[model samples]
Target: MGQEMYAMLNQDQRSIADTILASHRTQSTTTADSCFFIDGQGIYVMTVAWTGIAASLLPEGRTVHSRFKLPVPILKTSTSSIRPNNEAPMAPCYALNAVDILLRDIMNIDAPFGGKIMILGGDFRQVLPVIRLANRSELIAASLKSSNLWPYFKVIHLHQNMRTGPGEEEFSKSLIKLGNGELTSNEDDEIELPSSYVPTLCNRTILCPKNEHSLLVNEEALQRLPETEKTYTSVDEVECEDGDDITNYPTEVLNSRTPSGMPPHKLKLKIGAIVMLLRNLDVHQGLCNGI
Candidate 1:
């Protein structure tokens, strides 16, 4: 794991890792690389990244394992990492198949079941798999439901919302209805915003349809704040991996990118100011964008 990832872990997660590591070092057979056994306690703590998994399936990947003393390579699959994003289609089928083969051939598991334990988490309603240049059918096809592994999943529904504020059930139901596509107004299929959705002087937020609109609103709001403003400018650079520097991508080009994500070339804020996060940097930590 990267230092940043380790730093992001909460105390509970850190304690869990520490306890397990201590337990594995003394008595737990220490089956995995990160495992430790302590006296009579046995625990395995293997943390692998999606990119690492992809690298492991290569011929050279297996060679590295052979060179080292590996009892058996265990792989944990997270369906969230496989979901298609806006830029990519459904998870790479070849890579998935390779993993299945590795489980069967290397780990000695039956076909299809990748490892001894598979833990999957994420809400389907929140963000459907992205499929560009396609219709509803393609979008659905790119989702986990369309995969052969869907049948093995035992879907669990969470009914309670412990975080709900007073009278938030009604608001929650309204959102569910909107998500269900049950609130369309006419043939054009435009859903009317709630009466309270519009921005007001006393409202803490202004929900805009796009990031550009949001930026304008943010600037206006910041100016209205009764505090001294401080401006910070970002230094943009061309990278060999992320993008080619053949033309030395201009600062203007970088600034034109998504502000909701990729950091801005310049940022302005003030003490006691409010701002929205721009990405899912840490969900468990409640540090993701929009929160």
Candidate 2:
């Protein structure tokens, strides 16, 4: 169905579709050899070579010698997968190594020539490379030093939590607190005080239950309020035994008539509510506080 829809798109839309497809194809082939290709006069060349040295040696003596040129634009953009082991810890080795190669060989070769380099992945908290550290203390010390090669590069930390919902935002905060051993009864009290604000708790006990007899459950419930439905009478009637109710419930009633209606449930601000404000709004005024 998606393929048919994609095929039916106009020329301008098809161009975008082609660009996306090409990007996916590029990402799928992850080796240094497979990513790059030579193009000239609307002709597509081969996409892979045996090795960097082999690729450098190709343009001069090969059968396609006249067809190609040296210092071929090699794209070392995407990286291959890193496997995890029981003995080692996680680190950004493959990514760093790729960057090193890009700096030393790819970028350095055939000087006086320059090209635009763009990096488009973030969400660093989501996934990191599984690296086997030979010396942990040394690596840590090296990472800390500003003079080291690691610090020479610029890093853009993305502040926006695009993937998470309101519930997820609360859960993640709780997890951070739990990991730091700062979660206490005081924090719980703060979260569950106001009647207007519902506390979003991270139920970590469900992560690993002690015994097979014990049942683990997630307590968070999603409230969904349809535009046609005014009041949510069903919220009170529904009873969840395992606490695994994943239905989105509409907590507050929305003004269906108004186009720019208020959100069903507005987050209540407390003393220590860790809130993320929208970038454009005033940080002091428009901040919606509460986890």
* Candidate number of the best lDDT: 1
Taken over the whole model, the C-alpha lDDT of each candidate is 0.46, 0.30
Best by TM-score: 1
Counting clashing residue pairs in each candidate, in order, gives 11, 8
RMSD of candidates 1 onward, in order: 12.6, 22.3
Provide TM-scores for the models. 0.49, 0.26
TM-score of 1: 0.49
Model 2, span 1-291: residue lDDT tens: 667877776655465446534544553222221111111012233321212222233322111111122121222253322100110112233333333344335445421111212222222222233224636554443221222333322333333344467756776566456545566657445433233233454332245433222211211211222223223222222355645452533233332211211222223334332334322132123222110
> What tens digits encode model 1's per-residue C-alpha lDDT throughout 1-291?
456655775655555445534433542222232212111023232222122232233223211122222222222232211111111112322333333455446556453533333223334555554444768886676565666655544443344444567867877777777866777687787777766544464355457999888878878888898998988887776667655663777878876776545555668889878766644354335443444
Model 2 poorest ten-residue lDDT run:
81-90
Q: Runs in model 1 with CA error above 4 Å?
A: 1-108, 111-123, 132-134, 156-177, 192-211, 239-260, 278-285, 289-291
Give the true-structure RMSD of model 1.
12.6
